[model samples]
Target: MEMNRELIVLINARLVGTDPQYHRQIVSHELRENAVWIGAQLHGKDGTATIRTVAALLHVSPSTVSRWFQPGEFERECEYLSHAFKADGSLKPSIPGRGSGTGNDGQ
Candidate 1:
């Protein structure tokens, strides 16, 4: 599973670098379709990031995040994750009911 995720990242990275705008559009579309491969890629580049951590970062319920990981959940909130973790942090998206947190729980 880990190896597969890494390979997916490598392929996507190449695609992303070659054409960033197109890559984002593809990723967004894949998420909207709830593609399992896209979910795995969103899981984390290293596959070590936890669901709870991802949920907290996105300011959504853990269940919502879990659904994003499912094979077909129509991940409407993926844009938030992509914007928060993948995009440049200069501008932040306003996520409803989530204000803006840096995922810091005073650890």
Candidate 2:
């Protein structure tokens, strides 16, 4: 979907008076969580989030995401997804001259 400038304005206004970096971090983390949850709903086999689904959304391999689920695996992280979200939170495929859209971006 096309970005709603008005909505972005409203959200940014509400975020005023708070640390911009902190808010950005929070939004980044939340977006990743949301993506994982949505991916789970679509591809999980047991009504739970799966590495394969989340990996697909993050543009990574299943093994990369699975490594994060391992016990005592703090070294692995969702840094890629965080950065990706910061770059573009839409989580849609981009096409030249046509903003990201599974089918349409309201353009």
Candidate 3:
């Protein structure tokens, strides 16, 4: 959403009054918590990073990623990683660019 002038002013004013420590603890952590840790083990085998890059590395189709991951899956992952990651995390496949269209991630 585009921020209007009033909203920008409010954000600026709030920032002015906000303590650096409190801002870091309150805002930064929340942003970090939502960010996908694509470098983590279950995120991808090698050095996969970012959702788009992970999808590319895994070769899983973009639609498949969107569907299986319900948008917030990464956020949940940032909060709680699980052992059933890769196995249970399996998603439906995309048509050729060429692959099984089963579980194969074009890899």
Candidate 4:
């Protein structure tokens, strides 16, 4: 089972992502998406650094970041990441949650 690093970071969950590599891949992915949206929305990045430069701004390998905007593997990565982890940071049924959170706890 794979897990997303961003959700883990967002929810402050301690559960290790399915695979450390996958976790990194997810984080890198989110960062790329955020950057692209920002660039697109703000109407910036034009007459400026290219995607490779954007990758540098996001602190990821240019190739990796480029993959985010590209059509093929990027889409697959998104799918894998979605099925990888849940909103609350559960890594599917096989892996249990590992946080101090009490989402299902009775108050």
Which has the greatest TM-score? 4
- Candidate 4 residues 4-41, lDDT tens each? 98866855545654477888877776797765543342
Give every collision pair in model 2.
none
Report the number of the highest-lDDT candidate: 4
TM-score of each: 0.25, 0.30, 0.29, 0.39
lDDT (Cα, tens digit) per residue for candidate 1, span 1-107: 35688788888788666678887677655543444333344643443345555556555576765654454333433433443444222334456546347674344
Q: Is candidate 1 or candidate 4 better by lDDT?
A: 4
Candidate 2 lDDT = 0.51
Q: Clash totals for all models, in order?
A: 0, 0, 0, 0
Better of 2 and 4 by lDDT: 4
Regions of model 4 farther than 4 Å from truth: 1-15, 41-49, 71-107
Residues 4-105, candidate 2: write the lDDT tens digits: 998888777786634788776676666556555454344323333455667677776767555445542321233323323322233434445564545565
Q: Name the lDDT value of residue 105 in candidate 3.
A: 61
List pairs with backbone clashes in candidate 4. none
In candidate 1, list every pair of residues with a backbone clash: none
User: Where does candidate 3 have its weakest 10-residue lDDT segment?
Assistant: 82-91
Superior by TM-score: candidate 2 or candidate 4: 4
